[model samples]
Target: MPTALAIAAFSPSVLLDVATTVRAADLRDWDIRTVPATSSPQVFGDLADGAVDAALTSPDNVLLYAGPADNPLGRMLDLVVPVTVDRGLDLSLWARPGLGALVDLDAPVLAVDVTASGYALAAFALLAQRGWTRDRLNVVSLGATPKRRAALIAGACDLTILNAGNELLAHAQGATRIASVDELGPYLGSVLCRSAHLDGERAGGVAAVGQALTATASEILAGEHDDLVTASAQRLLGLAPALADAYLTVLRSPAAGLVGDGRADPAAVRTLVDLRGASDLRRGVDVLSAAGIH
Candidate 1:
């Protein structure tokens, strides 16, 4: 019988490379279930309650949920990141059509998964670069990237950060990208996380999944999986050929895409901490070490 594992995330497309590799390996028969999440809190809550085995989530979420700070769940949960995922899949702030330039929108509404998370901080920083502060706009807590994209196209939110192919879809719908997360310095977009309270068998499963994902990332960076990745992007993200190729370009970028080694970069973690203004909350905790990422 195959071991079943449920992994939650905003977009399952991010797991395309590893899922195919894992299936091909067949070293361990594993039923990897991809559970779609609408928000970080739902994912983390599922993780905390053991409804899900792991989550591909924002690294800053690991920092906040595991640290002394209050997360959206209202209480801290013991979480560990077994592996760092992508750098940033073109994470950027975008505006609806007819809004040109950062200054063109008058009192624009900003949509975010949550105001206190990493992406939101990046959005605020991008806006700050143009002298637009948080108070300058109406910020609403719209869940996840897809929801935000829908809101953006529906004219519900004038500005929001999107990535992982959501931005491409938004652009296809006539949205304009204002600034990339690259403008914010070193950034880690995602990590594979799970509760630290797993049993022996479950822990081993998580480790195996992490190793497989890491190997897949290494292969991707080495240019060994270009065709597979491109096809996966097209199938998983519903992206056209050109956009799928563009996403592949991002996945292959060492600067802004997949972390080939599965190791967390201290500088990137620091970037997330600095952006969230929670350096003080992270005191005495070796963020990477605590997350089992040496």
Candidate 2:
């Protein structure tokens, strides 16, 4: 019988590379399951409770939950990131249709997964660049990217940050891209993580999964799987041909895409830390090193 592995993430859209990785890693015997998450806290909570075997989440989340930070869970959980998934998914800030300039919206509502999540922090940093402070905007915690994107399209929220094909879907609905996370410097979008308390066998399974993902990323960067990626983007993400091609382009980008070798870059982790303004958390712990990133 196959060992079951449940991987939780915010987005329901599947990545083609993940399927390819499973095959390449000979994990055919592993019953890999993708669980959709409504919020970051829920994902981490499940991870901490051993309800989920692994998670695709942000590095900042690893920092916040792994130690005594003011996380929504209100307690420390021993978590670790084994592999970085993507650079930033081309994460960008967007405005509802006809929202006008960034400076024109009066107390516009900003939707986010959570107040302190990495994407939200990036949105705040980008808005600050345009002289918009957090106090000036009506920030709402809407849970996940898809929820935020829905709220943006329905005019429930005036602005939000979106990516991982959510931005493309929002753009198709007439949303306007206002700013890119690239403005924030080096950034990591997602990581494959699990509780640090896993037993020997499960821990080895997680490591193998990470290696498989890294191999898939390497193949993607090497231009060995363009057609498969494009098709998967279309089928899984519901992106149009042009948009799917664009998604592929983003995936192949060295600056803001896949981590290729699975190792989390120290500079990217530093950017995440700086964006969150939790420099004190870095005092005793090198998050990158702790996450198995050299």
TM-score of each: 0.93, 0.94
Clashing pairs in 1: none
Tens-place lDDT digits, model 1, residues 27-101: 356677888898888888899999999888888888778775467888888777788888888899999877767
Candidate 1, residue 204: how far the Cα is off, in Å: 1.2
Q: Alpha carbon lDDT of residue 289, candidate 1?
A: 44
> Cα deviation of 153 in candidate 2 (Å)?
1.1
Give the Å shift of residue 47 in candidate 1. Answer: 0.8
Query: Residue 9 error for model 2, in Å?
Result: 1.1
Candidate 2 similarity to native, TM-score: 0.94
For candidate 2, the clash count comes to 0
